[model samples]
Target: MSLALDLAPSASVEVRNVDLAYTRKARGTAPLSRFAVQADGAALASVPDEMEVRSSHLVRFSPTGKPATLQTYSVETLRKVEISTSGDTFIGSTDDDLYVFKDNKKSRFLSDRRANYTDIALSESGSRFGTVFCDMLAAHHTVALGDQTGRTLWTKDLPFAASAVAVSRDGSVIAVGGEDGDLWLLDNARNTVLKHRQEAAMEAVAVAGTNRVVFASGGGAGVINAEGQLLWFTEIVGETVALGTDSVARTVAVLARTDTNAGRLILLSGENGLPVWEIDYEDSRPTGLSVSANGEFVGVSLRDGTVCVYKLFYGDRLAAADGEAVLAEARAARSGDGSLLQAVALLQARLGSVPSDFRACDLLKETLTDAKEQALALSANAEEIGDFLSA
Candidate 1:
């Protein structure tokens, strides 16, 4: 006897595989000391030169996984090491010193009285950097901004302890999130712009563009505008481990752990905190997460002493098909129908992955111009405008 099985439509939908572009093993068993992505999409990682000593060596890897430069540091522990887009490096260490390494020279910039710096953030241009200091003895935390030369620009004391800090790409805004659920947005002049209270202690914080800030806490993650308004919040299944953002693309990548201790990466829109996609990894625990400047790639460092890079546009094959369908629907509809505008947006999103679509770009430009003209005409008509406003 033979049996027949029925399958759902979703089963027939092609499942695109995400490419594990590259993997590099850490130097020793201690895992990666720290890792950051450069502005040009290169990755920098630090690993112990020796298994028993506190000394470490920093390694630079190209986007294609080729090892580039390697530098040795005598510092004991490099807590928060960040590299600017321009190849400048800023690092805070257990020795209570902040150092700036540029042009093959290392200079000690600031000596903190605190135990160690909890986090460090660098501006896109590497002109400015910010750090969060954890002074356990004084029972207070401080957020300090500094220039490229490692000179302290300004410092702000917080009532609660902060572990996460971030500066906007333009170096115009600074954000600090504390363990006591305090969130502060400050201007470059050290003036407070907005302050809010979060439900849980913050684990990560990032600035997206000029007006949006994203943060992850024990409860989950959320996004806020520059005006201090809560845009949206999403609850995760477990601990929020790390957060990374692409300011240019307005995309946020979050690393969290499931209840079973599996690692998962979630991508969200920076504007609305809406979920875009997610990937799960059961074999390794994520220690660090970073997205490229253009949001085209994501790199994850695992506790097993391996770094993995994945492409963001691997699912574009499916998206292009959906875009074609939307365009067909728009063409079949009436000229003034809203489907045309929807088609334009769909095409725009697909263009992120398929930038060579000249036909779609031309159609989008024309549709946007038509929509703008229609809007202007409606506003010029008094009766039509009044009716639209009332509705």
Candidate 2:
């Protein structure tokens, strides 16, 4: 099962889906076999019930080369879809309206709200779903399966005109970005409002981790905690964009326009409004930005039909410095010098590395080794600095 591309009469195909569909042509006889080319793309063992040829065009594809409404044929159309890290497929749907083919059956994770559903997002573990409904007005809901014969978990009324919805990897947090320029974070387990903002109209939103939310709205991007504290904010120039978040480390990656030219990926620290890293997409705008469950890599899908992957590492500069100080203390202790502790104190105060670096083993040893001398020196120097600090 490899991806097959249509040969434009006689042209080399650069990239195409390794599926059982392709366009081909021949001289006088009927067109050549469209499935002649051996496949080489995202593997698909069996076609799903709903197969839309055009992007965003939902269509149910029959094994015999027919397309229908996804919800029409109950047996085949309702298919559960799951994407594995190694490119394996899983089948299962939640309790909502949009059903998926999973476990050889049709399942749904959304409510059958008569309102038009605009967006849906599945949790990283496929245990929950977040959906947006636009009726006379718009609102959002996050649903999870309960531990009963057939029970479901739903959040309280989230009456925001949501543009997008995202759930955390652990399914602890659900975020909805409103088209009306408001963002709401919900605690799915407890059905509580963790945080919300009405400043920017959200264009895109993604759960960074368990407690962090990343949203792109108005002309800027910002991150907020489960408690709704504004961690950081920055500007990006794009009308339509995508966001990815890392909850554990509280980081965000924004795929937005760069210099009014092209789209780029900017990784920001959720703690401070500072950029950790960025990647350029040249003249292309991103359709999606996905961060892996492990938070090690991010995948950006561009409008030009290209997907790029980037590796990311969280940098704890203050923590590293603190670790160095602890090591110095340990070394001092091993050397039987008592002055090491005083040296550490002075270093920590001067460098402001006190609470951040708690794992200062070697530093502790060094501090212990010089403890006696340091204590004497401190006693003398304290008189000068103590009054200065006190004053």
Best by lDDT: 1
lDDT of 1: 0.67
Best by TM-score: 1
Writing each residue's lDDT as its tens digit, candidate 2 over 22-66 gives: 211111111101010111211111222235421121222222343
> What's the true lDDT of residue 86 in model 2?
25
Assess the local accuracy of residue 370 in candidate 2 as a C-alpha lDDT between 0 and 100: 64
Query: Candidate 1 residues 73-111, lDDT tens each?
Result: 666566556765545554544436677765556677665
Off by over 4 Å in 1: 1-18, 28-35, 38-41, 50-55, 112-116, 134-136, 259-261, 314-391
lDDT of model 2, residue 390: 95
TM-score list, all predictions? 0.69, 0.53
When summed lDDT is taken over every stretch of 10 residues in candidate 1, the lowest stretch is: 1-10
Q: What is the lDDT of candidate 2?
A: 0.47
lDDT of each: 0.67, 0.47
